[model samples]
Target chain A: GDQVKQSPSALSLQEGTNSALRCNFSIATTTVQWFLQNPRGSLMNLFYLVPGTKENGRLKSTFNSKESYSTLHIRDAQLEDSGTYFCAAEAPQGGRALIFGTGTTVSVSP
Target chain B: EAAVTQSPRNKVAVTGGKVTLSCNQTNNHNNMYWYRQDTGHGLRLIHYSYGAGSTEKGDIPDGYKASRPSQENFSLILELATPSQTSVYFCASGESQSQNTLYFGAGTRLSVL
Candidate 1:
């Protein structure tokens, strides 16, 4: 069984549009982090959240540990945003390794 | 921001050959991790270390081993490579074991023939 599950395995968005990606955790996690893996295969850290919402420019993320879910919203999508989005959670039993979701492949086109 | 670098961006190894992937982080973070990414599996942890001289097995550590000899370096070893071990490997470093942010390396693509 997967401790972390992501929805909408893949998505396509036109430039200037908005979309949301989600991750659901079955385990009791304390925190969550989001990452964007660019086409060049570099994983860039996006946001790290606890139990609230955070906004950074055109990207916003929310984490609800009580409900065991997290959401990443992209506003005004750009071609540069085309990449794979992954969410990882920190669980008590997961040790130093964060449990990761299957990831959402996002393709933004002009 | 932490800077994690992985060596040998691409590698091809014969079956039963030994392969070692290296990682170096300049941030001096206490936690470092090794993970493999596949098409459908996303990113799965193979090993992690809290600091120098401390290595721990991760979720998928069956055919792999790890060594952390110093605070800035970590290595993942495949003693006997197999086709199943073909994947993209990434190294990450963080300041804490929990509630921490991680910085990742560019990733190493390994193909076992």
Candidate 2:
């Protein structure tokens, strides 16, 4: 079984639409981090959370340790937003390293 | 902004040959990690370091060796490369083990024949 799983393996959105991606953890996670891998294959950090919500620009993320899940919301999607979104969780029992989800591939089209 | 740079953006090696992937960080972070990304497995931790003179094995450390001789550099070594080991490798640095945000390098694409 996977310790971390992400829903909607893939997604498509209109340029002006909004969409959300979810990550569910089967392990006891204490923190979560989100990253976006661009078409160029460079990964950029999006958010780092500790059981709360965070917003930056058009991106908002929430992590609920009790529920063992996290969500990433993208508002007014743009072509540039098309990429793969990955969420990683830190479980105390899994050492100090993060356990990563398979990831959600997002495509925003005009 | 923290910068993590990985050298030789790409690599090719023959079976039983040795390959080394290097990473350098300018943030002076205490924690650094090495991960390999495959199609279905996503990214799995291979090795990490708490700081200089310390190295720890992660979930998948079977065919990998890590070295952290200083605060600014960490390297992942493969004593005998295999085709199954062919994948994209990433290096990251963080302020702490689980508290701060992590910054990743562009990645190193390796192909073993």
Q: Report, for every candidate in turn, its global Cα lDDT versus the true structure.
A: 0.91, 0.91
Q: How far out, in Å, is residue B38 in model 1?
A: 0.5
What local lDDT does model 1 show for residue B87?
97
Residue-level lDDT of model 1, residues B49-104, one tens digit each, is 98999999888999999999999999999999999999999999988744568889
Q: What is the DockQ score of candidate 1, to 2 decimals?
A: 0.72
Per-candidate clashes, comma-separated: 0, 0
* Single-chain TM-score of chain A, each candidate: 0.95, 0.94
Error of 2 at B97 (Å): 7.1
Q: Candidate 2 chain A, which ten residues in sequence have the lowest lDDT sum?
A: A90-99
- Poorly placed runs, candidate 2 (over 4 Å): A93-95
Error of 2 at B13 (Å): 0.5
Candidate 1's residue-wise lDDT over A12-59, tens digit each?
999999999999999887789999999998999899988999999999
